[model samples]
Target chain A: MQKIILNQTWKGMLMEVKRSSRTKTAVSVVVPFILLAVMIGYVFGPGSELISFGVVIPEISIEKVEFVDSEIIATVRNTGPIAVDIVMADINDRIYPAAIEPDKHLERFESAIVRIPFEWNEGEPYAVGLTIDDGTRFEKQVDVAAPSIQPTVEMITYFAIIGTYVGIIPVMIGLLWFPFISKLSRSKYKFFLALTVGLLLFLGISAAEEAIEISSENLSDVFNGVLLVATVAIVSFLALNFVGEKLKKRAGASKLAGPIAIALMIAIGIGLHNFGEGLAIGAAIVLGEAALGAFLIVGFALHNTTEGFAIAAPMARTKLMIGRLAAMGMIAGVPAIFGAWVGGFVYSPLAAVIFLAIGAGAIFQVIVTIMRWIQNEEGKLSNSSVLAGIAIGMIIMYITSILV
Target chain B: MLTGGQKMIIVITVVSLGFAGYLVFPAMDITAQEQPEVFVTHSGAVVQTTGDVLDPVYTIQEVEFDPEKYLREFDYGEVSQLEDGTTLREFTIIAEDDKIMEIAPGIFYNVWTFNGQVPGPTIRATEGDLVRIHFTNNGDKEHTIHFHGNHPAEMDGIFEIVGSNGGQFTYEFIAGPVGVHPYHCHVMPVEEHIGHGLYGVFIVDPKDARQQADEMVMMLNGFDTDFDGENNLYAANTIPYYYQHHPIQINTNELIRVYVVNMVGLDPINNFHLHGTLYKYYPTGTDMVPSEFTDMTTFSQSERGILEFEYEYTGRYMFHAHLTEFSEKGWSGVFYAKDNSQPNMEGYAYGS
Candidate 1:
């Protein structure tokens, strides 16, 4: 009877141990797989999304809006079946909460007359908008409402930094690679010079085309812009020439001076073009087409990456310091931020014409200087290579433009 | 002072370092410059003064459609007949702008789509139906719809079937498919047109149709954020994580049929894999019976098939590319069985 009891207890203990082991094995296998699946989702989920997921979205519209005394009376409708919470309305530059509650809820196909106490100026066209809490924003445009031109602090920051992001890349690459390029013999350097000059000339023509096309609606505007461009080009040419001669007299070496001056002028020309780009982005954003604006930023960022090559290629023969490159980057890229600020706030076709014209003219002047330099080198560079480079440059620029 | 070999090594080192630096620069993103408080003038000029002009860019305006919402299968119009007893499927494919969608968790692609959805709205018709596609270019560019199936030349969307900005074109054809067919803009560069979300699936049922149960149209596609002639994103039905997040719920005993089309342009090949089961696979929609019964299927560009199967057990079944690399990277998803009780309802669309 004692042996029988002991055997029964031993069987019970073995069974319990076996059960516990099975659970441990299951947990060990299942937990890691679940974790692995989550980790995979996290890594592959967001970055570089090739296609978008089609999800049902809530569609909201401002049905009716009017200012009553110091307050604004607005009717917003949820056209879709989703309930929208925390809708905020914008009047002028100030944002007024649309509802009295902590959150505004609009159910499916529901209408809510949100009495937003908006601060408005008498007789001033006020821009109005209503936004749901889910990051969906909408603007109500009245005939008397003025266009919104003031940029938010974030936008200003975006413009300021985007220039460096877009404009610094190519120039920095060129600057860094200059060491290897300088190692090339004199004849090879001439070919490089020709390629650089060809690229610059192409850019000059592009700027010219933009200036003319922008002012195409008005002949007088075109004439004024072209005249200004020509005048500025000649002035830059003469001014740079005079400065170069003076530097030659003082510095005792003309080689370094020529390259430095050319680099500076190229930076200035690029600055003007970048400003134009900034203006475009700002205008697109202010037009309430945020997607279009974002695309413009991306497209320009891509273009600027290549533009840096143009800026630094000419300095291949001249070794430079990082500080100078940084300064040059600032010189060329900083104007983009200012341009965005101006472009977003203002719609002056004349100003756009002027800015584009200045860029075209400055680039033209640089081209002439480089061409003259190349001619002095004579047969040191292959004219065919130069021609080929020009064609390549034009094709590349055109392709990049189309991509945008 | 250095030997030639040592000099070569130094040069190589410097070149490598420069390359490394260039790659790292974009990430470092040397913080953007400081901005000074400035005021805007009514005339559109910015000045370094206070209280000067109307504000812009800061005005919180309304946006068009929210793209973060989960995507669901959309129905255009149903099949109908005229007095002559001829069935007609008329599809209005409008190429419009400002339609952006989230392909992944936070990555969004702004696409010029047909009627506002990527892979457009799927068209379903029998073998001999008169299909009419009305194409409208409501966006900024010129576009045209070209079908990839057996159709008459005049009805072909390319070569003279072109529509300019804000213009329209109509292509009529008798729906005939050899399986699943793809329709897209055949404007000069087919890659650019397709890349911008201008393609969709066109399904034509066979005269002797197979036993129909539950059906799905899966257009295996990709998205290239940078136009480097390569796809950085891959998915089916144009939405990333679509099936994984919103599993297609089906009954356990019901036969499932999935029409898969690999619509990738840059990449050479794409594939499909089903977990826990194998199915009768028909490569190329023109086949009467499937050539193989397999759990995994591989396809190159433009290749498509009809995969048929059913589940006996009540559980979540995952389907993805047999290429494990491709499967985890946006090409994988879960299938909720007819008996699935708990559906992950995040990003679920409430209304039709």
Candidate 2:
């Protein structure tokens, strides 16, 4: 009976082991399936709702404010990625029935004029608020609401005067260093040429950087704005190179013509750079974003003086006629006037990108030309004086740029 | 003797394999199911199911849209007499690009629209009428109404980009060509404009009108909800499977005229097919005479035509893109034809 009990115990042990193994096998299969099912549910479930909340981002930029005969006219542009409907306009937190010229609806990059007959005082502070269809309000405050200046002859003259101070006068002042540069030795001449190279290089790099930033930030993607900047820069570089090469080949026989051609190229490059600066200043005034004080003008004047020095360095040894020098100065400065006119009257980001790109390309091509000329004069590059001149030139530009 | 570490490793390997098998096997099954299946119909024509369905993968409350209303709707514009004794049709179309619409079930898309709806409005006018479009762009992007017909350079819509945000442009021209054409935003990157639903049918009747029939507009359009350049969903108006769910009702033996416009972007070509009957097709509706009698027709983007047919037998008929992929992906619909002489027939109710 004891033997029989031992056999039954062995059989029971065997059955217990089999049952536990089956349970383990079943768990191994089912647990993974359950976990996977849960994962799938989490990933492809209503819980992961796409675009759950309707996102409405309304943005409007108040470009200009004007007071015209008991009426407050505010020019606004829709700067957001979405369309905005202007439903109401308020003056000093009080709602007013405003007439929106054209339409109340503004698509992205579209502008509208809002006219509110509020009889606002000229010297009093007033806040203008525009309510979009989404209930988001954009407010612009005029600390002293005054009659805004329209783009008239006086405005054009004002822009031209500012451009002269910023572009021409300071450049002419830098050209006063011409006599001193002309007295330098051949080695010193090479150093000054390298200095001009440094200055042009700095200008080229900064212009390219600004063009890239503006194209990416301000312009629409449909324009392929960044690519536009790159393509325009490349195209301009090739174009200027072509023009420079043609000039160099035409004047290859005359030693005087070489310096004059280089000076002309330098003037064109500086002019393009000055044009971009003028566009910025003009656009700022038009948008009422700039505080154009005496300090700002002086700072710009000081900054542009370096550009004149760069142009003068290339023409130091050349016997240039006064008419030619005057012409070169105008070439390097007069574009500012045209730029200001375009920017004030019809400012477009695409135009800004293209002009800046052209400036950068011309400046870079001038650097290449100057380097080749230096190589021809000095038999080799990388002297201590040349390096020091480049360093000093860059430092001067950096210091002046800070003031601006 | 096996170490404890080895036992643990074995257990982990077994579990991981089990998990992988569980996930991978189903994925393989789904991939297999995605293959198109061919099925021969009773009429001896082979039809294939593309296996592309409105697989939402998630459920949400459906957005309401009436395809029937849009199908037959035509905007004649405010009609008046011009100073030259010509009929003047003035249409004020508002363009908006910031409209979020639920294109498919639970699939919302930011669609650029005209007067708040996709495919805009069907603009109808008699040939030689002075058609003036007072276009206002209220959207946050540049837009312009470019009519696909004979007009002056300035009225061509290209180069005359109307600004966004309360920008206005008056497109005035004499309507001609005596057929159906598409009018859409002529903005650069035109595909994005038309793809987002900133397009509509412009139908100009001949000097002499044709026989009056049940006229309807069937614009074949697609939506790329993911912005991937490839279309994910397609439909006869804007909604997929809408007409299938609510079949278009018509009287038997009545002349049915369908003004079909294919504005499906991204895909190179699309086609239309009718089950149970053939119809007379007029390519672009330019010619007065029918081009052919066929059960199917092909179309490139912006291609349109007129299809005229009469039902002899009263029943439900299927109309869809002949391309199986498009039809499976929400481009399918049905037409319910009933004899008016038969009174109170069971299951003959509209949309039944």
Local lDDT at B271 for model 1? 88
Q: What interface Cα RMSD is found for model 1?
A: 21.4
List the candidate 1 regions with Cα displacement exceeding 4 Å: A1-404, B1-84, B338-352
Q: Of the candidates shown, which would achieve the greatest lDDT relative to the real structure?
A: 2
lDDT of each: 0.64, 0.78
lDDT of 2 by residue, B1-352 (tens): 8787658756865874575343212112223334564432212333333321112111112455557789999999999997889999999999998888766544557889899998799999999999999999999999999999889999999898898899999999999888899898879899989899999999999989988899999999997754656676789998876776567888888999999999999999999999878999999899999999998999999999999998989888999997877875678887888888655443232222
Kindly state the number of residue pairs that clash in model 1: 27
Question: Which of the CAPRI classes, incorrect, acceptable, medium or high, describes model 2?
Answer: incorrect
Ten residues in sequence with the least summed lDDT for candidate 2 chain B: B52-61
Predicted candidate 1 versus true structure: per-residue lDDT over A79-100, tens digit per residue: 5645665334545423333332
- lDDT at A102 for candidate 2? 52
Model 1 vs. true fold: TM: 0.38
